[model samples]
Target: MCTFRMASNSNQMPRLDLHKDSKKLSRAQLDYMRIIEQQNLERVRRLAKQRSNNIMVGCLLGFGVLGIYGYSIYSVKQEKFLDELD
Candidate 1:
């Protein structure tokens, strides 16, 4: 079990044992670990969202390029046909 004592001097920081093993961590250390874990989880979620957005943008750009290529081919075919008729 963890124990805490209030400091008599207002300017002094509370003493804590932060060097203990994980199984014997103090209350303050436990709270700190929880905060770190939550932050890491948030970071992972943000990275995943960014990756999905990049994939979507790439797919859209690829389709746009394909459409432009198809249109150019069709235009060339029409020009060839007109030349043959002349």
Candidate 2:
């Protein structure tokens, strides 16, 4: 029960024991480990891509808003509205 877990990130890998005589995994267990590792890798890759996209979008929106504010001030200055007050 991870209280701070992210909803989209969930992964579980089962524990397996090696063969006592061989000191290695059986053929099926090895295959299972490979498959699980591949799945986990794919999940990691997908999550990384998603995170990069989110960061890019957030940065673009943040910078765009800042640019908008800067332009607003520049346009207002061009109007000389404040000149009337002074």
Candidate 3:
């Protein structure tokens, strides 16, 4: 009877249940999230304002350069027209 024990040959691995114990957030956690979200929105607004002002300044400078270029071309053309009439 001592030499009649059977040998086991099992190779199965244990499985884990991922969702067996999940906890919900408390009210204070939610309030903190809301405050963080509000700060993010304010930051976005400030960045947008800065972007718009930068675009406006760029447009003004562009127009100033184009105005000078156009005036120079116009003066040259007027001078050529006057010379042609001579």
Best by TM-score: 1
lDDT of 2 by residue, 27-83 (tens): 786788789999999999999999999999999999999999999999887996778
Candidate 3 lDDT, 1-86, residue by residue in tens:
36776565477544434355223556776688779999999999999999999999999999999999999999887776766787
Scanning candidate 2 in windows of ten residues, the lowest lDDT window is 13-22
Error of 1 at 12 (Å): 31
Model 1: per-residue Cα lDDT over 1-86, one tens digit each:
99999659988866655565566776887998889999999999999999999999999999999999999999887776766787
**Each candidate's TM vs. the true structure?**
0.66, 0.62, 0.55
- The prediction achieving the highest lDDT against the true structure is 1
Better by TM-score, candidate 3 or 2 = 2
Q: Per-prediction RMSD in angstroms?
A: 12.1, 7.7, 17.2
| Poorly placed runs, candidate 1 (over 4 Å) | 1-23, 81-86
Pairs with steric clashes in candidate 2: none
Q: Given candidate 3, what's the lDDT at residue 66? A: 100
Q: Global CA lDDT of candidate 2, please? A: 0.83
